[model samples]
Target: MKFAIFGVGGTGGVIGGYLANAGNDVTFLARGAHLKAMQEKGLTIHTNHRGDIHIEPCKAVSADDYHETPDVLFICVKYYSLEAAIELTRRIAGPDTLVIPILNVFGTGAVMQEKLPDKTVLDGCIYVFAKRSGPGVIEQPQEILRVFYGFRPGQDSRLAEKAAELEKIMRAADIHAHFTDDIQRDALTKFSFVSPMGAACLYFGVTSEAFQENKEVRETFIGLVKEVEALGHAMGVTFDRDLVATDLRLMDAFAPGLTTSMQRDVAAGGPSEFSGLVSRIVTLGKKYHVPTPLYKKIDDWCKAHGLA
Candidate 1:
C-alpha cells in the first residue's frame, strides 16, 4: 500500500523505514538535518529486536512538496505539532484516504475526525521508545515494536476491516500489530501507567528503579499512580485497583534505572508532553472533584526545575 508518514522523527522513522524495506511505497515528510540526511544517505534504524536495518535512497519530501495522495497516512508528529500536521494531511488526503494518528493524547481521534470528516480516522497506540541518535538514524529501545489500533466510536465497518488488513500487512512487514476493541481505554490505560512514572521520575531526576530504591521515593511513586488513577476513573476510564499494584511490581522489576522517555526529554530540555500527561491529570482531577495531591506535588516540582 502507498503510505505517507508525517513527522518522521524517531518513531516515524523506524516504522516507515521498516515498511519501506518491506517494499511498500513509503513517503516520509520531514525537514532540517534529519531530512537532509535521509535524502543524502538514507534512514538507518538500529534496534535490539531486528538488529541494524537501513533504508537508503528512501522517498521523502517536505509536507508542501508531496504530490501523491496516499492510501494511508500515518500522523506521527508530537502532540504540539498536530495542528500543522493536520493541515499537511489535507494537502495529500483523498476521499478514500485513512488517517492514523499515533499519539498519547486521549481526544486526538475526535480532533482528527472533526478535521477530516470524509476520511477514515483511527486511533493508534505504539509501544516502543526511539530517539534520533543522528540525522536519519534511529536508536530503537526494543527489538520489536508493537502497534494497536481501532476505529473511533460511531465509525463504520470499513475502517475496522481496514485496520484488520493493516495488522496483517504489518505482521508481514515483521512489525507486530493488533486490533483493539476499545482504543480510548487503551490510550488511557497507557497514560495511567506512563504519565505517573514520567512525573515521578522527572520530579526526582532519577529512573523508576532508582526512584523506587528509596523507600520514601517508592511510596511517592505509587502515590502518583494512585492520584492519576483516581482522576482517570473520575473521567469515566475505569482501571482496576490491581493494575496500580501491578505498576509497582513492574517498577520493582524494571528497577530504578528505568526511566520514561518523558523524563529523558525533560532532562535534555526538549519539548515534552507534560501538559497532555500530568497537567491534564491534575486539571481533570479538579474538574471531577478528585484529589490529586501527588500530581500537584510533582507538577510543582517539574515547574520549579524548569522542566514544565
Candidate 2:
C-alpha cells in the first residue's frame, strides 16, 4: 500500500521507517528541521528490537508539498495539531483514502470522522515508548510496539477489507497490528493507561519512578484509572479486565525516570495535551454522569498553575 505518514514524530517515524525499510511505498509529511534532515540525510530509527534502521532516499515533504493521494494516511500529530491535520486531509485525501489516527488521546478518529464525514477514519491506538531524539532521528526506548485499529460500532464497513489488508501489511513490517472487532473498548483500554499516567505525572511533577515508589502518587494514579473505568462503563464499554490492576501492572513495568509527552511538553513550557488527556476526562465525566474527582482535581490544578 502507498502510505502517507502525517506528523513524523516518534510514533509516525517508527511506523513509516519500518514500512519503508520493508520496501513498502511510504511518504512522510513533516516540516522544519525534521523535514530538511529527512530530505537531505534520510530518516533513521534507533531501536533495540531491530538494531537500527536507516531509510535513505526517503520521500519526505511537508503537507503543503504533498500532492499524491495515498492508500492509507496515518495521522500521528499531537492532539493540539489535529485541526491542521484535518485541514490537510480535507485538501489531499481522496474519497478512497483510509485515515487512521494513532494518537494517545482516545476517540480521536471518531472526532476526525465527524469533521470529515466522507472519509473512512478508523480509530486506532499504539503502545510504544518512542520519541524523536533529533532531527530525522527517532528513538524507541523499548521494544513494545503494538497497534490496534478498527471501525467503530454501527459505522460503515465498506472499507473493512482494506483495513484488514493494511493490518497484514503492518504485521509484515513487524508491527503487532490488530484489526480489532471492538475499537471503542480497545481504544479506551489503551486510554485507561495513558490518561491516568499523564494526569498523575503532570499533577505531581514527577517521573515514572514516583508512581512505583511513592504511596501517594501510586494511589493517585490508581484513582485516576478507576475514574476512567467508571466513565468507560457508563459509556457502554464492556472492558474484559480490571482497568486499575492492568494499568498498575503496566505502570510498574515502565522504565525508571520515564516521563510522558505531556509532562515533557509542560516542563518545556509549551502547549501540551492537557486538554485532551486530562481535561477531556473531566468533560466526559460530566457528559456521562460519572464521578471523576481525581481527574477534576488534577484539571483544577492545571488551571490554577496556568498549564491548561
Candidate 3:
C-alpha cells in the first residue's frame, strides 16, 4: 500500500517508520528541521521492546511537493493545526484515496468529509504513546500499540473493507489495528480518558511518579476521568464506567518515567495541546449542560502555568 503520513512528529514518525521499514511504500509529508533531518538521515525507531531500529532512506518530502496520490493518508497533526494539515491532504487526494485522521478532535472527520467528498474519510483512535526523542528519532513507550478505526456515520461498506485492508497492511508492518463497528464512540471514549489525564497531569503538577504515590492526586485523576465519562454519556457516547480501573491497570504497565506528551511539552517550554484535549472537553460540557468545574479549574491552572 502506498501510505503518506502528514505531521510526522511523534505518532506519525513511529507508525510511518515502522510501516516503511516493513517495506510498504511510505512517504512522510514533513517540513522545516524535521524534514531536513529525515532527508539527511532517515527516521529512527528506538524501542526497548525491539531494540534500536533505523529506517534509513525512508521517503520524505515537504507537503507542497508530495504529489503522489496515496492509498492511505494518516493526518497526525495537532488539532490546533488541522486547517493546514487538511489543506496539505487535499493536495494529494485522488478519487480512491482514503484519508484517516489520527487526531482525536471530535469534528475532524466531518471537516475532512466536507473537504474531500470524493475520497473516503475515516476516523481513527490510537492508544499508543510516542514522542520525537530527537531529530528523526521516534521514542515509543514500552507498551502495546493499538489502532482502532472505522467508517463514519452513514458511510458505505467499502470504507469498512478498505479499513480492514489497512488493518492488514498495518499487521504486515508488525503493528496492531482493530476495526470497530462504532468508531465515533471509540474516539469519544478515548478522548474521555485522555483529555482529563493530560489536563490534570499537565496542570496540577501531577507527574507520573506522583500519580503513583499520591493518593489524593490519584483520586483527583479518577474524578477528572469520571467527569469526562459523565460528559460523554450526556453526549450519547458510551464509554466503560470501569475505564478508571482500566486506566489504573494501564498505568502500571507504562514506564515509570512516562509522562503525557502534553506534560512533556510543558516541561520543554513548547505549545501544549490543551485546546483539543481539555478545551474540547469544556466545549462538550457546555453543549451537553454538563458541569466540568474541576476540569475548568485545572484548565485555568494550565493557562496560568503557560501550558494552555
Candidate 4:
C-alpha cells in the first residue's frame, strides 16, 4: 500500500519506519532537523522489547515540496498541528485516500472530517510508550505498541477495504493492529487512561508511580476518569467495562518513571495535548452538566500558568 505519514515524530516515525523497512511504499512528511536527518540518513527506531531498527533510503519531503497523493495517510501530529497537517493532507489526499489520525485527543476523526469533508477519515488510537529521542530517531519502551481503528457505525465507506489491507501490511511488519467494531467507544476508552493520567500527573507535579503512592492523587485520577466517562455517556457513547478500575490497574503496572507526553511537553514549555485532553474534559463537563472538579482544578492551573 502507498502510505503517507504526515508528522514523523515518535508514533509516526516508528510505524512508518516499520512499513518502509518491510519494503512497502511509505513517504514521510516532516520538517526542520527531523526532515533533514531522514532525507540525509533515514528514520531510526529504538526499542527495548524489539531490537533497534534503521530504515535508510526512505522517502521524505516537506509540505511545500510534496504533491503526490497516497493510498493511505496517517496524521500523527499533535492537536495544535492539526490545522497545518490538514492543509498538507489536502495537497495529497484525493478521493481514494484513507486518512487515519492517530492522536491522543478524542473526537479527532470527527474534527478532521469536518475540516476535510471529501476524504475518508476514521477513528484510531495507539497504545505505546514512545517518544522522538532526536530529529531522526524514535524510541519505544515496554515493547507494547498496538493500533485500534475502525469506521463509525452506519457509515458505509469504501475505505473499510483499505483498512483491512492496511492491517495486513502492519501485522506483516510485526505491529499489532486491530479494527474495532465501535471506534468512538474505543477512542473514549483509550482516552480514559492517558488523559486522566496526564491531568493527574501534571496537576500534582508527579509521575505515574507517584500517583499510585499517594491516596489523594489516586482518587483524583479516578475522579478524572469518572468525569470523562460521564461526558462520554452524555454524548451517547457506551463504555462496556470498568475503565477507571482498568486504568488504575494499568497505573499499578506502569514503569517507574512512566509519564504522559502531555506532562513532558508541559515541562519542556512546548505546546501539549492539554487543550484536547484536560481542557476538553472540562469543556465537555460544563456542556453536559457533569461535575468535573478534578479536571477543573487542573484546567484552572493550566490557565493560570499559560500551559494551555
Candidate 5:
C-alpha cells in the first residue's frame, strides 16, 4: 500500500520506518528540523531488540508539500494538532483512502470522521514506547509495538477489505497489528491504561517507576482505570477483561523511568494532551453519569497548577 504518516514524530516515525524498511512505499509528513534532517539524511529508528532501521532517500515533506493521495494515512499527531491533521486529510485524502488515527486520545478517529464525513476514518490505538530523540531520529526503548484499528460499531463497512489488507501489510512489517471487530472496546481498553498512567504521572510529577513502587500513586492509577472502564460500560462497551488487572500488568511491564508524552510535553512547558487524556475523562464521567473522583481530583490539580 502507498502509505502516508501524517505526523512523523515518534509513533509515526516508527510505523513509517518499519514499513519503508520493508520496501513499502511510504511518505512522511513532518516539519522544521525533523523534516530537514529526513530530507537530507533520511529517517532512522533505533530499537533495542531489532537494532536500527534506516530509510534513506525517504519521502519526507510538510503537509503543504505532500500532494499525492495515499491508500492509508496514519494520523499520529498529538490530539491538540487534530485540526491541522483533519485539514491535511481534507486536502489529500482520495475516495479510497483509509484514515486511521493512532493517537493517545480516545475516540479520535470518530471525531475526525465527523469533520470529514465523506472519508473513511477508523478508530485506532498503538502500544509502543517510542520517542523522537533528535531530528529525523526515533528511539524505541522497548520492542513492544502493537496497533489496533477498525470501523466503529454501526458505522459503514465499505472499506473493511482494505482495512484487513492494511493489517496484513503492517504485520508483514513486523507490527502487531489487529483489524479489530470491536474498536470501541479495544480502544477503550488501550485508553484504560494510558489515561490513568498519564493522569497519575502528571499529577504526582513522577514516572513509571513511581507507579511501580508508590502505593498511593499506584492506587490512583487503578482508580482512574476503573473510572474509564465504568464510563466505557456506560457507553455500551462490553469489555472482555478486567481492566484494572490488565492495566496493572501493562504498568508493571513498562520500563523504569518511562513517562508518557503528556508528561514530557508538560515538563517541557509546551502543549500537552492534558485536555484529552485527563480532562476528557472528567467530561465523559459527567456525560455518562460515571463517578471519576480520581480523575476529577487530578483534573482539579491540573487546573490549579496551570497545567490544564
Candidate 6:
C-alpha cells in the first residue's frame, strides 16, 4: 500500500523508514536539514532490537513538492503543528485514505476528525523511546515501538477493515500495531504517563532517571498521574489497571537520561505541545469539576517561567 508521512521526525521517520525499507511505496513530507539529508543521504534508522537500517534511494519531498494522495497518511508532527499538518493532509488525502496521527497528545483523533471531516482519522498513540540524533538519522534507544489505534466502538464505516489492513502493514515491518475500539481510554491512559511525566520533567528540568533518583520528583510525578487519572474517571473513561504503577514501570524501564520531547523542546527554546500536554489536562479537569492541584501547580510554573 502507498503511504505518505507528514512529519519525518522521531515518530514519522522511524515508521516511514521501516515501511520504505521494507519495499513499500512510502513518501515522506519533511523540511529543513532532515529533508535535505533524506533526499541525499537516505533515511537512516539506528535501532536496538531489529538492528540498523538505511533506506537509500528513498522517496522524500517537502510540503511544497508533494501533491499525490496515498492509501494511508501518518501525522507524526508535534502537537503544536496540528493546524498546518491538518491543512496539508486536507490537500493530499482522499476520502478513503486512512489518516493516523500517532502523536503524544491526547484527543488528537477528535481534533483531526473534526478538522478533516471528509477523511478517516484514527485515534493513535505510540510507545517508544525515539529521537532524531541528527539530520535524517532517527535513533530508537528502546524496543518499545507499539502503535495503538482504532475507531470508537460502533462508529460505522470501513475503518475497522482499514485498521486491520494498516495493522498488518505495520506488523510486517517489525512494528507492533494494535487496533482497539476503546481508543479514548487507551489515549487517556497514555496521557496519564506522557502528559504528567512531561510536565514534571520539564518543570524540574530533569529526565526519567530523575524520577528514580529523587523522592520529591517521584512524588510529584505520581501526583500528576493521579490528577490526570481522576480527570479521566470523571470523564467516564474506565481504567481498571493500576495507572501509576504502569507509569512507574515504564519510567524505570526508560533509558538513563531519557527526557520527553516537551522537556527537550523547552530546553532548546523550541515549539512544543505545551498547550496540548500541559494545559489540556487542567482544562479537562475544570470541565469535569475535578480539582487538579498538582497539574495546576505545574501549569503555574510553566506560565511563570515562560515554558508554556
Collision pairs in model 4: none
Clash count, predicted structure 3: 0
Q: Can you give the TM-score per candidate against the true fold?
A: 0.89, 0.98, 0.93, 0.95, 0.99, 0.97
Record all residue pairs in model 1 with backbone atoms less than 3 Å apart, i.e. clashing: 48-143, 49-143, 209-255, 209-256, 210-256
The sequence of per-residue lDDT tens digits that candidate 4 reaches over residues 197-236 is: 8888888888768877899999888888888888899989
TM-score of 2: 0.98
For 1-308, candidate 2 gives per-residue lDDT tens digits of 89999989889999999899999999999999999999999999998776989999999998999999999999999999999989988988887888999999999998999999988888999988889989999998788889999999888989889999999999999999999999999999999999999999888999899999999999999888889989999999999999988888888888888889998888889889899999999999999999998999999988998988
Give the poorly placed runs of model 3, Cα more than 4 Å off.
none
Give Cα distance to truth, residue 2, candidate 2, Å: 0.2
Q: Which 10 successive residues of model 2 have the least lDDT summed?
A: 245-254
Score candidate 5 by TM-score against the native.
0.99
The alpha-carbon lDDT assigned to residue 203 of candidate 2 equals 87
Please identify which of the two predictions, 4 or 5, would achieve the higher lDDT against the true structure: 5
Q: After superposition, which runs of candidate 1 have C-alpha atoms over 4 Å from their true positions?
A: 238-242, 245-259, 268-270
Question: What is the per-residue lDDT of model 1 for residues 72-143, given as tens digits with 9 covering 90 to 100?
Answer: 899988787888877877777887677888876666767877887777778887766676788889887555
Measured over all alpha carbons after superposition, the RMSD of each candidate to the real structure, in angstroms, is 2.5, 1.0, 1.8, 1.5, 0.8, 1.3
Query: At residue 212, what lDDT does model 6 achieve?
Result: 91
Cα lDDT tens digits for candidate 5, 1-308: 89999898789999999999989999999999999999999999999898999999999988899999999999999999999999999999998999999999999999999999999999999998999999999999888899999999788989899999998999999999999999989999999998899899899999899988999999888888889999999999999999999889888988898888998898899999999999998998899899989988999989998997
Q: What is the lDDT of residue 210 in candidate 5?
A: 91
* Top-scoring candidate (TM-score): 5
Report clashes for each candidate as comma-separated counts: 5, 0, 0, 0, 0, 0
- What shift in Å separates residue 51 of candidate 6 from its native position after superposition? 2.6
* Cα TM-score of candidate 1: 0.89
Which pairs clash in the backbone of model 5?
Answer: none
Q: What lDDT score goes with residue 291 in model 6?
A: 97
If both were scored by lDDT, which would come out higher, candidate 3 or candidate 5?
Answer: 5
